[model samples]
Target: MKVIKSNGEIEDFRADKLINSLIRSGASIEEAQEITNIIQLKITKPTPTRTIYRLAKNLLKRTNISSSMKYSLKKAMMRLGPSGYPFERFFAKIMQAYGFETEVDIVEEGRCINHEIDVLAFNKNTVVSVECKYHSSAFRASDAKVAMYVYSRFKDLEDKLKKKYHKKRYEGWLVTNTRLTIDAIKFSRCYSFKAMGWRYPEDGGLEKLIEKKKLYPITVLSIKQDSLQKLLKHELVMATDIIRISNEFLENLGLNQRKINQLKKQARALLG
Candidate 1:
């Protein structure tokens, strides 16, 4: 039976539409098909968003296999590898979901110069600087380097903004795929800063804050089925297919033009 729209049911799954979405997102037909197969197998329950989220996560991994069936899809994803700006995009989604007026890739003035904050939030008289990270494993001590850099940059940015807009209150936030380091956690607690990680909500640590609506927790992948339904209707993607082909096509045209110029030069020489 077809799922109905009013009852929050998923419409018929169309492999062709899924394939086209993947292609639009830059996946080849073969890769898109493989991802589709994996998604079909994994999404056994009735959730569309989790299906897309899981599919996106798995497809971003690098596959290593000599044969078609036994590849190890466990390698680390490089920066901006898939979903280009995935973490920033994810953080932006969370902020919007929570009713914050937000801007992605916002520039703020630091002590020395202008720095870019990944996501900037404005709520009444308050301004918030947000940093987002998506990784395969827990955050490391070294990863704090990025946190510090963002902090340093944002100081300048915030000062600049205060002057530019004459604001007196501002805040900061850091969002990561994994939980915070012990040191980072301690630092935030002492400073009254806001930070959120994947493990934070699972441990019931966020229940009070979430209940009070003081913190915006990342909504569970399981609960965002509506998001998935919306995603399915929106489009599918491979992450890198179209851009690669377009780049190659442009390069080939440039090469052909060069070769044609060489041929013309030789023809003129022969005529002389």
Candidate 2:
């Protein structure tokens, strides 16, 4: 059977790939095999990768809640938005957790134009103007056009900054919830712009960075939509934020001790 990848490329589907993914997410050998068997029996035609992911997640949820949660991390990131702003804020928090001072939604004057940066992250030596591209859907990717735009903006800023703010090196970055197109990756590399996405850079992509820093979004938890919205409305985004809050505060949210404990356990497991 053919499988449509997120980038819209069609390829032959391999059941072993599905099994390996499940095993990587902490499913046992037997459970992974069983899930793969079920999926093979059910899937008759070409399927989109997102549909397969959803099916796997559903099966995993029935077998192991923790594994299901783990598998859902990328989807949870996609859920961080009806708009890109929330994801930008979440990205800023992740940057902060990694020791970079960050500012969101800053309008800075470039050499010839004013640019609104999604996130500005800096420390002692490096300053990065970030363009955060968030997509509500998992299948969409940041393409070459995005790369070109961000690169132009970066060049303008770099030109302006060199004449004034000369001490710290300035850079540009494009971060996204989904993957980047091949052209996007090529352009970024050619221009010395850092492009980060769900799986870009292979080793240090957004997912790896989040895992390394133990900075997971609150949406990753298996919570009721109403409760999750309440937390989001209060600007509570991180799993660590939930852990840091007092028991009284959680009680005020109408969560029982049992539910709170479950959340805590899930959050901690995600961090590791």
Candidate 3:
């Protein structure tokens, strides 16, 4: 269920949990299951996510997929905990990189309820909301339930905001790691709901970015058992260290400030 890192730090992970992560990352049920099976059958290492990264790289090459999808897939594989907050933050960053003014882990209030939208963005007359998943398969009933709940709430809020602030109606984006459920995908396409992970460019700009090494995907398993135990027993092992490491990697690779900030926010949220 759990795996160790190269530094001998232990972290607990369950197969079911990984399945959920995969679903959140936008994988289909079948894809998530297959990836889970492969990990269980072939991974005997301190860092299974690392193995997952290699496997995914091979998949991208063979499938000729886009870098954007690959990025999301790698994130699902390396996710350390149950909360989908990290991936939400990643979506926040990608939006910023694409030129939206963004907020991570936003709390929106309307009609006497406090709604926590994963990401919120604004650009001139446009306001947008995003919900992120890092799953390995298609969305489930629960996913639809939550999405409908939030979207319905925001629907009212959108009207209120438009009337009060004279701003444009808000756009809702459901960004998942894997693909959407059939119904969800249908709803998105018909209703202006934006989905990620479809279509590899024929020229494949995203694929080329990945293949040329402009974008590097690093997969990290949780801390090892002994290290986790020590930390639980009062020894210190700050997960924020991963933030520092990720920052170094991004900066070294010349990731834009927007991207760095997004990753930094995710690291802080996860470590805290």
Candidate 4:
């Protein structure tokens, strides 16, 4: 059967693709297969990709709620938007979770001009100037222009960044919530700087890294808008943060006991 993609492209549907996605979202092989078989039986017409996504999500929820939440990882990343600042902060937290000292939304004095870096990550060996390209639309990607811009800023500040951070090795990096265009990957190869997105770098892409640390964003959980806004307002972005906060802290933020329990339950399921 054929399926309609979100970008309005019609293509043959592959059951294996759906199975793999389910497995990645934390489903066991048995569960993934079961769900895919059901979806295949249901799709007699050329259904939109979003409809398939919803159907899979619903089935996954029935099988495993935690996997259902994880299945929405890409969508949850987009929910951090309307403003890229949240992504910047969330990226910094991801860095910190991996033991890199990070700063977000900082201005650094480059040799030729001042540059605003989205995230500057420092380890014992290297300093990286990171630019985060956040797009609300899943189909949109970071193109060559983004790679060029980040590379230019890196060239201007490489020396200063190294000296200031006391790291001999330095890099200009592009990190996006979406995919990278082919030209963008090509441009990054030309300059030898890192340009990474959702599935880039094969083994260590953004989602892989996040799953490695269980550092999912708070937006991934099933929560009401008001509770989510309050969490964002308090600068608590990581799902694990819900695990760390005191009950009183959550109460002061206007979250009732039931809401608090729900957050903790999902957070533990994701992180533990």
Candidate 5:
């Protein structure tokens, strides 16, 4: 059977890929294989990836709620944006975990004109100017066009950025929630900048980084969407951050004891 990606591309369904994804999301090998079998049986037609995602998530939830939450990471990233602003701040927090001093929504003067940079990250050795390409839908991708445009802006700001930060090295990073086009990756390599997306760069994509840091978002939790929004509004974005907050703080957000308890349980299970 064929599978329809969010971008409308169709390809033959591969059971091994499905199994691997499940295993990566914390499913046991046996569980992943079993789930893949069930998924294959369910694929009677050219299935949309979202349909497969929903089915897989529901099955994983039935098997193990925490694993299901981990599987929800990609979709949860999509939930982080309609506005890219919040995603910029969220990504800055991700960089902080990487030992960088970070700031979001920076307005910097370029050689040509002023520009509002999405994120500015600096360490003792390097200063990175990041353009956050957040998309609400999985259909959108960061292409060569975006890479070119961001690099142009980076070029315009490079001198001022380097002068202000006084770092030994400078980098321009294009960070997006979705996948980057192959051309974009090629463009980045040729330009010596960094490009990161959902599952590029083999060993260390955004998803891998999040898993390594246990930076899973609140959207990955099995909570009401409204409550998710409430948490996001209060900057309670990371599942890993639940360790730092008191129950009283959650109560202040109008979450009841039962929901709070479930939230805590889910967060702990996810961390494991």
Candidate 6:
């Protein structure tokens, strides 16, 4: 059977690939193989990759809830925004957790024009200007145009920094919640700009970075949508934010002790 990829391309379905993905999401090898077998039986026609993902998620939910939660990380990220602004804040928090001093939505005068940086991160040795591409749709990808634009903006800033701030070197990074187009990846590599997306770069993609840092968004917990929205409205985005919130505050929001404790447990698991 053929499967439609997230990029809208068609390819032959590979059961092994699906199994491997489940395994990466913390499923046991036996469970992964079992899920793949069931998926193969259920496929009647050309299926979208999203459908396959949903199927796997449902199966994982029945067998292993923890793995299902891990697999749904990207969906949680998508839930973070109707606009990209909230995602920028979440991204800055993630960077901060990793020991980088970060600033969001800062405007700086470049050599040619003033540039609005999405996230500016600096340690002692290096400064990075990040262009955060947040897409609500999982299938949509950041394209070469985005890469080119960010590269130009970073170049402008880098040139100015070299002339004035000669101590620290500047670099460009384009980060996305979904994925990048082939041309975007190629252009980034050719130009030496760091381009990272959901699964791009293989080892150091956004998902890998989040897992490595244990910096999960609060949306990953199994909570009611309205309650989650309330938390988001209060600017509580990360799972770690739950630690600071009082149980009484959650009770005032209509959560009982049982539900509140469950949410905290999920947050702790994701954070750890």
| Tens digits of per-residue lDDT for model 4, 216-261 | 9989987777777778777788888888999999999898999899
Q: Quote the positional error of residue 37 for candidate 1 in Å.
A: 30
User: What are the models' TM-scores?
Assistant: 0.44, 0.82, 0.48, 0.95, 0.90, 0.86
lDDT score for candidate 2 against the true structure: 0.85
Tens-digit per-residue lDDT, 1-272, candidate 5 = 89998779999988888888899898999998888888888789998977986898789899998889888899888887557766787888899999999878879999999988888988889888899999998778899999999999999999988888775588899999998998999999999889999988889899998888888877787767777677777777788666568889888888899888888888898887
Which ten-residue region of model 5 has the weakest summed lDDT? 80-89
**Which runs of model 6 end up more than 4 angstroms from their true locations?**
1-12, 41-49, 162-165, 251-258
Off by more than 4 A, model 4? none
Best by lDDT: 4
Model 2 — TM-score against the truth? 0.82
Per-candidate Cα lDDT values, in order, are 0.48, 0.85, 0.51, 0.89, 0.86, 0.86
Ordered list by lDDT, greatest first: 4, 6, 5, 2, 3, 1
- Candidate 4, residue 188: CA error in Å? 0.8
Over 65-87, each residue of candidate 2 has an lDDT whose tens digit, in order, gives 86787677787897786767778
- In model 6, the worst 10-residue window by lDDT is 160-169
Better of 1 and 3 by lDDT: 3
Best model number under TM-score = 4
lDDT of 3 by residue, 1-272 (tens): 56764456767545676665555444566766666676667756556555555564444333332322444534433342234654555455456555788877767766666677788887877788776655633332224554565466666566655665575656777665544456665555565555443222224322232333222222222334443333223212223333545455545545556755765554443323
Q: Which 10 successive residues of model 1 have the least lDDT summed?
A: 64-73
- Position 227, candidate 5: lDDT: 71
Residue-level lDDT tens digits of model 6 in 55-134:
99999989987778888888999988877877888888888877789989999889899999999988777787889999
Backbone clashes for every candidate come to 12, 0, 27, 0, 0, 0
